[model samples]
Target: MTDHYDAIVVGTGFAGAFFLLRYLQHAPPKARVLVLERGRNDCKVWQLRNRRTSSLNTEEFFINNNPEKEWLMSLGFGGSSNTWWGGVARMMPGDFQLQSRYGVGTDWPLRYEDLETYYGDAEVIMAVSGPADSPMPRSRPFPLRPHRFSDTDALLKKTFPDGWFHPATTRASAPTGTRGICCGAGICELCPHDANFSISNGLRRLHDDPRVTLRLQATVEQVETSGDLARGVSYTSDGQLRRATADLVVLAASALFNPHILLRSGITHELLGKRLHEQMPVDVCLNLRGVKGYNGSTIISGNGYLFYEGEHRRQHAACLIETWNSPFNYRRAALRAERGRWTERAFFRFMFDDLPRADNKVTVNAANPHLPEVTFNGYSDYAQRGVDRIPAMVDTLAKALPIEEIESIEVARSTSHIQGTVVMGNDPATSVVDRYLMHHRIRNLLVLGSSAYPTASPAYPTLTLSALSLWAADHLFTRSA
Candidate 1:
């Protein structure tokens, strides 16, 4: 790493990579940039094929306090984007005004329009595909057309006319540039065709730029701050403790580690590690009579926003229901004979928006202080309202389509969309960062990624988070220039 640089970015996730690329593009020609990644960038192809490798290891630096609720994250150069399912839904307009519109959760410091251009820019760069008629008022249409859905998704769309639509995703439908199109590998987390969007893909180009220095296997221990200014970052590489100075430092390490780094740096706030939450995945299986599910796509197909907002939200939390078009999850070894009749078994997935709670937080474990501990209260009555209404939704679908049987309805898993540890707002007393994403106490320090979210929308947040990062980069560089 350089002795001193114009900017330093920690972590190489969706946010970090976007910020780094933007910063380098906008920064003065002579300006230097350094990126510190905790994990190495080696054998990415091998990791994609094997499923389990050094790149996808469970982070030992953090542990979940609730055994039932796990917070999974990537430790490699690209971070979670390396293994993301590639869903890129934007937050609904109501998502920005949670407090004003619904009288629940905190409102974002900026509105949807403020980030609309950045969303468009990021989407175009990432090659996202979706319908322009999406519920959200976007400034422009997606870069590519929406993916062709499986027969099951088409049925869901016809049955639930008003609520359903093809999802905007990062998966490539047709060959674009050197990136191959999706072959419906069904294993998107490990895309075999290199079609799925990953920050690592961008980092490969940034690595070749002379202005940017990519430092892998370097763990940033703390951000050094002096009298409201961020000095730089201290990280360890090759068993040596090293400190690098920079004019600005951005933390995109993620929701869990970003707060841990701040707390370790002695930057204390009453809500530093508080208000952590994620969209808990709710699972339900159905036995369809004539329709077969699970073809075409692997993970996501389409989604329903009918329950996203209503008078129902006044009493219970809202949820976004999506169709799982991948057959890999529901396949049984003994059921090999039912390959073509795939729609016979189906899984309807629900992502309930988890409210931010002061009690649910990420903190250093008392037993092992070096390892982070996440404490989350599963769900509240708000979430229960969504769960209670699922059966009725199933009944509606059953009546419309060939009826068979409702096999099960239960809490399945989580999307690992860790959010709100270092939330942003206009007021520092109630938040961690300002509207520009700069730290309240440390002016030159900015925290990126989902960690800056005030609340977790019931949809995937990758596109939204990438937009936020680009917004931050524009603000940061425009002022400096």
Candidate 2:
């Protein structure tokens, strides 16, 4: 017996969710759609368990790079959307034209205008909370008004005074479906309510959809291709080998996994696994004089993007700074014991824009082709210049605000914003995919996620990736017909 569908989607994270939503909206009612996810659907179990214990990174996936460094991702039905602190920022318009505007990196094939409408669509679906006025130009306002600044955030605003705005977040201030109003528990990594947007909120509807069929805990091993067309995909479930045929295949797996699957299928283009990179997250710890930070939101409350894009890009990579609203509770007691003083502490995170390099990439080991071999070229001098800008920013804030001593600055070992392994562009020779995210060589196969990003834009990649997925789905289904 053979199983077949009009289309098949792999992974169920940010990219996959939006792709499926848009595809279903456009596909004929009777068109069959199959979704394969390697992780189990157990959001309730995980949510309950997380409340009892501090959730750790999943060990099911591994990389050949530094063992101490963890990739900020989750292996579950909803993917990282279930685990990540939900801060979604739209890319600055200049981000789309980096190469042309600043001669710093590869230019995205599509401009911000091309995806502006889809960005608005994603914001509504995710229930984003953001200020009416933002530094970045927009076609429309966010769906919900921005949350009020927590006491801690208000103090920071008074301190810095410039380039600040309420961040766009997925945590709801009102009920949307089964999601409840956020109580500001400050442990948002494991949001107790469905307040933070996660595909788990709509998992039931997707599973119940007549056009959709879901296969959980099914690990895809190969993309079956014949001649120039993608035939389907091969996978293993419960230790049994199975194959599903489809006219089109969409890969929304992580940047590392996407290339591994393509390599297994023997579509080994040189650009397939090259130019992998992630933003460097620099953590700054401040012992404040007059504020408490632990009582409000646990993740971000506001962001500063003054250096996100400017003429300075000719000398340095752009940078975005975000203020953490949660207090330093994890280390507060320990630090108090060591220093013998009670004090309020705050954390500020700086994310430097990353540039792509040919030397940085993902590859498959000959001995074990199933596993991924990740090589990071590390940060460039341009990025280091961005890191160097932080102290001046701190100095400016300190001079204008209350007395605060900078206790420490810690550079994070890892980040969730992985990108550029399978980049998109107009030239087939220099890129893996086209503007629609379709493989230059294999037209029936499309890849989504930050993997399609030509450069690591100086903003959170979730919203842009979601928009790109919808754009690709709309073009693929509507135009193909």
Candidate 3:
């Protein structure tokens, strides 16, 4: 028997989970929702356990936590949020108006003000804590109190100017009171404390809802499109091919997989895989003399903004101070620096927002039938400008936090925060989805998450993505009514 649903949400990441939660909250009594995830049903905490030296040597350690090779994507129901550093912040108001201000990227179909309510709602759902009011105008105050900073973070804040340094409230999906005591274990790999919020938690909440059904280990191969409308999804689960149909198909997969799924389904959009962008993050580490565990938590606790003047006046930039060095990871990074190679230690990371370039794209692998490959041809001139500012920023940070010995530092390929594969815009011809996140061609198909963001703003995309998902769900619910 073919299963059916009011809505079928793909991928159990932040976007997927947020959509499901909002749908359940607002959808009609008869609405039935199905969520498909490629990873296991439950959070895989055991996989992050037993992090010994051998695990590090064997590359068995968690990515972000250990020196293991782990992409930002996860193999569990919660998606990357399960293992993310839990540093959540909303995109600045200027971020939405990047095109008008800088004339570089396309403007979002919706403004930051349009999403203000939803952003506030998302903060409550995610339990974000920070200053009530954000630096950005038109933003509502945070629903909950902000998380307190560690001693190291406090010292850093004292060293930097108030405008130059702001204590950003780190938001997480973890239950309140689970942080601090969680020890921030395996943060880069997985949330060792289970304090980090993952969609798995939300999925679990809907287990008894009766209206919602979650299918794990079900990898969706394609969105079966009949003409311009997506009819169903073809997935492989437990070596069997299964198909499920939904009244509305929502693609909440990460920025990486969303475009691939659309392209595989033969859904043609002019900008389907074009204009990809990721904030270039430069990690800088300095070894403090006589300070043990100087780097406290993996979560970003502070940030600094730099606004350049001139033709680039509209371009906004900021650097976050997150992630303290783990002894093991630090040692490895130091060794790489000793060998004259770029490593994570001996430097702090400066995340720079870059203008989108059309050359960056996502396409299916020719040799591999099921694999998708992403190729970022090069950075834009605006990105080059950001790169140019790195030296000066690094100098400022180095001078502020002077260390007895500078170990090693380098920039590496990051999958932690990538966005804009399927962006939303006013013109259907230029964007994959409309302002409401509905596919331009497919009436019953909607795309949620950072994938629909036109530009990756200076702040973290999770909170904004969550808010957008909620907004999309609200629209779909009202429409269904």
Candidate 4:
């Protein structure tokens, strides 16, 4: 027996959730939808009690050949939403015009203006709090009040005034019927107070819709296509092979698995599973002179965009700075045990955007045919230029804050951000999807998420990717009902 649906959606993370949120608005009353999630639903209570997002980890589905390069994700009904920290930032206009502006990387088929309206829509749905003034241009003020900055942030603000603004975040700062006020606890993946946005807390209702049927613990093997049209997908469920067909197909899985599924289905492309990359991150800790921190209303208080946009991107990757203000900020608190040191230290995380490289990519695992083999060669020379400038960047930043000493500067092995396995562009030869995230060849197939990102921006990808999903769904099914 075979199952059929109006649409078959794979994964339930930021991309799939937002897509459904909008798709349901236009889908007809009797429309049948099938949702496939590799992991079972873990309620918010179960996640908080376990002190983690999901009991089912990423290791079960894919094989990470390069363990030194970390790629973190959760497998459950909500996917990465269970583990994401809920930081939200829009991509700069320049991010979309990278190649034309900086003579590096490929330009996205769409523009910031194209997705600007959807960005606000996604923000409203998530109930984001942010300052009026922001680095990226906005049409109107955020839905909620901005999170207040810490005492240390005030001093840093005076030092680096430009582009230093309160971060827009899904971690609640104001009262909402769905979520609680943020208490600045850094364990956001499993917020003890249920403060951060998770699918269980925010969009779980989508799966409960009578028009939709959600199947859990079903691992998709490949998409089954007829000619240039995608028919549906094949998967394993209850230790048996299963088949499903739909009028429309949405491949909303993570970057790794999205390309992996396409490859398994005999969908061939020169750049299908190539260009696997993410932002390079470095953690910097500084002991301030007589100032106290950990006083912000949210986990991350502010974002510094001084080095985010400029001519410098012509030579080096743009860098974004995230100020850590949560109570769970420091890793080695024992080192700061000297009298009054607890309140005197500040931590800042810096991330540099990296261009996708063909050498680093995903391929079908020979050992286990169902798993995807990940290979990350390394960050490009453009990104390396930013790494070499970190010491000087810190020295320049030291002049802003009254730094007593530089405690530690370490490169983080993993940013927990994976992207670029399938990118969007105007030309089918160079990219996988088109401007609306529809497959260039397979018109009925839509692939959503950070997988469509052409380049990694130092700013987080959730808000932008969620907006993309909304835009894609609207572009396709606005009149379906």
Candidate number of the best TM-score:
4
Question: Per-residue lDDT for 241-281 in model 1, tens only?
Answer: 99999999999999999999898888889999998988867
Model 2 lDDT per residue over 83-195, tens place: 77778899988889988999888789999899999999899888887888788778889887787675556765665555777888888866777687776766776777767
> What lDDT score belongs to each candidate, Candidate 1 first?
0.79, 0.79, 0.65, 0.86
C-alpha RMSD by candidate, in order? 2.3, 2.6, 5.5, 1.8
lDDT of candidate 3 over 1-481, digit per residue (tens): 3598888989777888888888888877887888888766443444565432011121211112223322355555667766566566667666777768777666788888999888778776766656543456544665445444444445555665443433344444234654433353334455455555455543457645788888877888899988877888998899999999988998887877888888888887778877767776656666554333324443444555433223453554434444443444432433233332223234345666767777777777776647666666655666557666665665665544545554545565663677888988878878888888999879899888888878766567788888888898888767653
Per-model TM-score versus the true fold: 0.94, 0.93, 0.83, 0.96
Ranking of all candidate structures by their TM-score, best first: 4, 1, 2, 3
Per-candidate clashes, comma-separated: 4, 0, 13, 0
> How well is each residue in 320-392 modelled by candidate 4, as lDDT tens digits?
8888886465444413667766767778889999998999999999978788999888899999999888878
The lDDT, on a scale of 0 to 1, for candidate 3 is: 0.65
- Those runs of model 2 whose alpha carbons end farther than 4 Å from true positions after fitting are 50-57, 155-162, 294-298, 328-343
Flag regions of model 1 displaced more than 4 Å: 330-342, 366-368, 479-481
Ranking by lDDT: 4, 1, 2, 3
Off by over 4 Å in 3: 42-45, 49-71, 138-180, 184-188, 287-298, 306-347, 395-409, 479-481
Q: Kindly indicate the candidate among 2 and 4 with the higher TM-score.
A: 4
